[model samples]
Target: MKRVVFNQKGGVGKTSITCNLAAISAARGLRTLVVDLDVQGNTTHYLVGEIDADAFPAEAQGAAGLFKQTVGSRKMHQNPDSFVWETPWENLFLLPSSPVLTQLERELESRYKIYKLRDALQKLDAEYDRVYIDTPPNFNFYSKSALIAADTVLVPFDCDSFARQSLYSLMDNIAELQEDHNPDLAVEGIVINQFNSQARLPGELVAELEAEGYPVCATYLSASVKMRESHHEHRPLVDLAPSHKLTQQFLALYDELESGRA
Candidate 1:
């Protein structure tokens, strides 16, 4: 599965979802690769421990390549795996990212290179069993590329009124992508994150989303100290606290996604 965990809205747990899903998928013995397309490099940070800024046409081995339109298809396809890093987990790998991707976007946007990533991934999708893309906070070239390359998409939404509006807008964008670029890409479901059921507002918002017919993912990731600490330690929540309540929730969610697939 080529899955993109995306949302235009920031602070909605996109990286957390991407990382956890990748880790779980890899742990299941499926060769999983995470493509960090976010300029924030949070995914890259958590996975690779650091981002290398200086790999030119060559991506610093499993490091995220800045979308290079001029790089031949042969070359572009070779780089993602070249930058693929070995993680603490057995089967998980990462294509790390850096701040340079921000500038790469500006350069490509002018050339109308909207589907650069999709074009690149097509040449190499056969190599990995699962590909998870961690997109940037806003809808930009990377976001478009993720949507285009995805076989499945997931949106991690927060519990807030403004995020609700952004969620609708994101769905509209996905619809457009489905119509024009990727017809087969399925939107798996919505993962509600940073949720505090004890709080009235978060619970209320989850209710609203469910009532509105949103496919709320079975797992609700809570705002937990361990979740935050795991990122700083450069590991997954499951690795950091396998028995943690939130970690168990994510594990169960992973099982559902794995089994529920048609």
Candidate 2:
């Protein structure tokens, strides 16, 4: 399955959900590939740490490279697997992001290379048991490409009024894109992240969303300081603290997501 974790609003745990969910899949012995399309490269750093400048791949090596090569080329010269970098975790791999992605955006859009990402990922599908894409916080070329490329979309939503408003706009965008670009793409559900059960507003907002017919995941991820530590240490909760409450929540969230697939 190819799933993309996306949200137009930032700080809603896009990278956290993408990396941790993909990490959990890897831990289950599934050969998973993470495609980081965010220009910030937060997902890349979270999974692979700092990139060695001297050893970084050339212009056609990472996700940026893959997109750049599609500019005028009629055929893909480099195999999708060639750009994959193995993460520290077993069964997990990465198509690291690059700052150059920002530079390539306008040019890629002008050339109508939106379909290239979908094509490249199709080639990779046979090699990977599961593929997860992390997109930037907007409906840009990269994010659009990810949406079109993915078989399913998992939207990360932080329980707040502002996020709720953004979620409406985001849903509209996804609906339009599904009609115009990927007819088969599915909105898996809205992943409620950083939920605070102690806060009345959070519960009220979630109830409101559900009342409006949004597919909210049953498993709500609680807000925790351990998440910050996991980010600082560059380890997913599944591997960093298997016995922690937050870790169990992540595992349960993974199970919830998998059950949906069934």
Candidate 3:
């Protein structure tokens, strides 16, 4: 299955969720590929440490290369798999993000290459058991392409009042995208991230969302300093601190998603 972890709001744990979930999937023995479309490259850094810019050309590396190949005379010559990079983890692969994505966006949009990602991923259906896409924080060219390519979208909610208000606008945007671009795309669930059980506001906000009929997943990810340590170590929680509470919550969330698929 192809799943895109998306949110128009930053600091919502999109990178952490995307990388950790893909890591869990890989650990479970699925051939998982993570496509990072965010130019910030947080997902790339999380999976693979800082890349040497001089080692490769922007137009020939990672997601930028994949999208770059879609335009001009270079189109369709390279296999989509050729752009993928291997991470340190077994069964976990990455199509790392590059800063050049910002430069290529206008040309890609002007050429109407929104469906290129979907087409490429379809061709790769046999090569991977699961595909997780990490998108930019805005509903821009990259995020829209990811939404168009994905089978479902997992939204991250940070349990803030401002985030709650933003959720409405985010839902509306997804609804519009579903109507216009990807009719088959589904909202897998709203993952409640950084939940503090001792806090009254978090519970109240979650109750409000559930009462309003949102698809809130039962597994809530708690905030922990270990997550930062995992990031600093450039390791996913499943590999860094599998027995930690946050890691267990991630495992439960992963199981919930797999069960839903089943």
Candidate 4:
């Protein structure tokens, strides 16, 4: 399955969810790949740690290179696998992001290469058991590409009134994209992240969403300091603390997604 974790709002845990969920899949012995399209490269850093500038590929070798190579080319010469990098973890791979992506958006859009991402991912579908894409915080070229390429999208919702309002707009954008670009795209569900069960406001806000008939995931990931620690160490929750409460919740969420309960 190919899933994109996205939100048009920052600080909503998109990178965390992407890396951790993909990590769990790898831990289960599935071949997993993470395509980091965010210019910030948070997911890339989370999976592989700080990059060595001396050994890093040029702007023409990462995801930016993939998009750049597609421009005005009658055929794809570079294999997509060449752009992929191996992570420290087993069965996990990364198509790392680059600062060059910030400059290629307008060029790609003017060249009408929106469907190129979908085509490339289709070529990789046979080789990977699961593919997860981490996108930026807006409906820009990269996010749109991810949406078009993915079979499903998992939205992250932080319990707040403003986030709830933004969710409406995000849903509308996804619906429009689905109609125009990928009719097969499915909204897996809204994942309630950083949920504070101790606070009455969090529960009330979630209940309101449920009352409004939103498809919210059954598992709520409670806010934890361990997630911050995991980030600092560049380790997924399952790898950092398998027996921790938050890690168990992540496992449960993964199971729910796998079982089609979300």
Candidate 5:
């Protein structure tokens, strides 16, 4: 399955949720590939430590290279796997993001190359057991491409009033994309990240979402300092602190998603 973890609002833990879940998928022995479409490259940094630009050329780097190949050509003849880089963990691979994506976006959009990502992923269907995409905070060219390419989408909702308000607009955008682009793209669930159980507002907000029939996930990821440490260490929760409560919650969330798929 190709799953895109997306949210228009920043600081919602999209990178954290994407990388950790993918790490868990890899741990379970699934051949997992993470495609980072965000220019911020947080997911890339989380999976593989700070990339030395001197060693890897921007044009030939992960998603940038893939998209660059489509600007002039009518079809992508290059092997999609060529853009993928293996992570430190077994069964996990990454198509690292680059700052170059910001430069390539306008050109790609003008050329109507929105479907190129989907095309490339279609060619990679047999090579990977699971694919997870981390999109930028906004709905732009890259995010749209991910949405078009993904089989399902997971929205990361940080428990906040602003995030709650943004959720409505985000849902509308997804619904519009479904009608205009990939009808098969399903909203898998809304993952409540950085949830504060002690806060009454958070509980009330979640209850309201549930009552309104939004697909709020059963599992909630708590606010923790371990996640920051994990990021600093460039290790996913599964690999960094498997026994921690936050890690266990991530495991539960991963299982919830897998069971839903089954």
Candidate 6:
């Protein structure tokens, strides 16, 4: 299953959801590949603490070198093994991104680019049980490419009025992509992140979203200091503190996501 965790709004925990889900899938021994479509490289930086390095795992390095092909390079369309590499985690790989990925629009403007990413990914020899795509916060080419390639999408929300409304925008974009580009895509569910149960607003928004036909995940990521610390320290929260509240919440969400795939 190829799953993309996306929101057109920043600060909605898209990276947090992407990395944690990839980490959990690796823990389960699935050869999981995460494509860092976000040019910010937050997912790449969060996993490895940096993006530019000579000595990356095979999968990680492979992922980074992928977009370097000029979209029409003679080297383009090489086997996934040629560009896909390993990260620090077992069974988890990344297509790492650099500042250069931000130039994809300028780079791929001329090549017969109909569903380019989908075509490229379909050529890969790898058999990942799951592929998670981390998309930038917009309905641009990068994100639309991911949406077209993905079998399912997990929309991440921050539990706010505007944030929830952003889901409408995202849904509309998804509708457009499915009609014009990919017809097999489906929305898996909505993931509510960075919640504060003590606040009345989160509770209210959850109900409102559910009423609007979104299957809300039972697990909600908490607004925790440990999660912030994990980002600073560059470790999964489960590795940092398995007993922490946020860690357990992520684990629950992971379980829900995995079960959905099953």
* Steric clashes per prediction: 7, 0, 0, 0, 0, 10
lDDT of 4 at 225: 92
User: Which has the better lDDT: candidate 4, or candidate 5?
Assistant: 5
**How does model 6 fare in lDDT?**
0.77
lDDT of 5 by residue, 1-262 (tens): 9999999999999999999999999999999999999999999999999999999998888999999988875656679899999999999999999999999999999999999999999999999999999999999999999999999999999989999999999999999999999999989999999999998999999999999999999999998899999999999977899899999999999999999941
lDDT of 1 by residue, 17-93 (tens): 89987888888898888898887889878876754345434333333353653344564444445556677788888
- How well is each residue in 169-257 modelled by candidate 3, as lDDT tens digits? 99999999999999999999999999999999999999999999999999999999898889889999879998999999999999999
- Residue pairs in candidate 4 whose N, alpha carbon or C atoms collide under 3 angstroms: none
Q: Name the lDDT value of residue 67 in candidate 2.
A: 88
Ranking by lDDT: 3, 5, 4, 2, 1, 6
Candidate 5 regions off by >4 Å? 73-76
Answer with 3 or 6, whichever has the higher TM-score.
3
TM-score of each: 0.89, 0.97, 0.98, 0.97, 0.98, 0.90
Better of 4 and 5 by TM-score: 5
Clash-forming residue pairs, model 3: none
User: lDDT score, residue 92, model 6?
Assistant: 82
Q: What C-alpha lDDT do the candidate models reach, one value each?
A: 0.79, 0.90, 0.94, 0.91, 0.94, 0.77
For all predictions, the C-alpha RMSD in Å is 2.7, 1.4, 1.1, 1.2, 1.3, 2.9
Model 4 / residue 145 / CA error / Å: 0.4
Q: For residue 221, give model 4's deviation from the true position in Å.
A: 0.5
